[model samples]
Target: MSEFTSMAFGSAWGVKDWDESSIAPIIAREVQNSWRVRGMGDFAVGARECGSATGMLEKWKVLREDEIQKLEDVKWIGYVGVRDATTTSMAVGDTSQPTTRPWQQMIELRYGFHPEVWGKGFGTEAAKAIMGWCGKYIGAERFIAEIEIENLGSGRVLSKMGFEEIEKEKEVIWGMEGTKEWKIWVGR
Candidate 1:
């Protein structure tokens, strides 16, 4: 865990192994923000079902079990992250690509942080660290993201990290229909 943490931590924040105690704060923060739920739908594992701590923990355990599934089914390889007043989660996983590009491995990257830390650069820091780990451990060659059009903050973070916009389309975000901007971050 220390080796992994060293790879994802910086001066202000760092990724930590999942702790059940931390789930409460995350759940408390998330259930109150529909945008957070919608923005993080794909990578959150159980955003819709996370209205309660027990439910969220149950879903997380299932995700942990499913973590061992075939690569194609892998939707989240993530870490729980903490900074002074911030709690975040980061994930990278194999995402579905167009049938026309069956051979292209589109690894998707995403992060969710408590609103208290919004605009504080924790998102960028955590994303940088998680991406660093994914590059080293998963050997991901390319990464993609589907962000809500309203989430300019996340888009800005991606821009800072070199993710370029590729497409825009309407999609279900956290069980609600909305426009999503797709972007890709390529490894150099």
Candidate 2:
């Protein structure tokens, strides 16, 4: 994990690999709040059945944060990172699908930023840094992201980072109507 912690930085921000340090609780709270702010929706209903903040925090044990103390240009916005998809039941992708590559080679990317930084390019910047770090240190060859179809801002960020729409699925989101989920994929 120390290898993953040595994350690269962009001009405006950097990513610290998710860890159980004092920063973990902060990252957990932000990760929870950012989901709704980033357009995933409220978890008032079916929180556990659907992908609630509590559920996600437990599912995505591997996360990363862009600590403001580590940056000089912007306030602490949120997190952007990847996790081993083969090992975890991904929120979107069909984990049952088989891949010839090793489990470590395929990863799922997730990100969230404060509303203030929504229109800014920080998501792309932080995403690029994390992807670069994973590719170099984790030997990750494939990256994927599961986003709500309505989250065009995040789609734009993924597009900017060279991700392509690999698939889409319709599902019931907690406390919301059926929503379309877009699973984007890219190769390093």
Top-scoring candidate (TM-score):
2
TM-score on alpha carbons, each prediction: 0.43, 0.50
Candidate 2, residues 1-188, lDDT tens digits: the string is 22122212211234454557878888567557534332221111010112444532222112235522222322344666676545443333444544444545456676766554466566776677777776676666667665654566777887877776653343211112222323333352
Residue 28 displacement in candidate 2 (angstroms): 8.9
Off by over 4 Å in 2: 1-74, 90-101, 168-188
Give RMSD to native, each candidate.
Answer: 16.7, 16.0
- Which structure among the candidates has the greatest lDDT? 2
lDDT of each: 0.45, 0.49
Which segments of model 1 are wrong by more than 4 Å? 1-104, 168-177
What is the alpha-carbon lDDT of model 2 when measured against the actual structure?
A: 0.49
| Residues 1-188, model 1: lDDT tens digits | 44223322321335556677878788666555523422222223221233355642233223243444444433333333211111221221313422222112345565665543456565676667655655575455565655555667778888998887753233221222232434454455
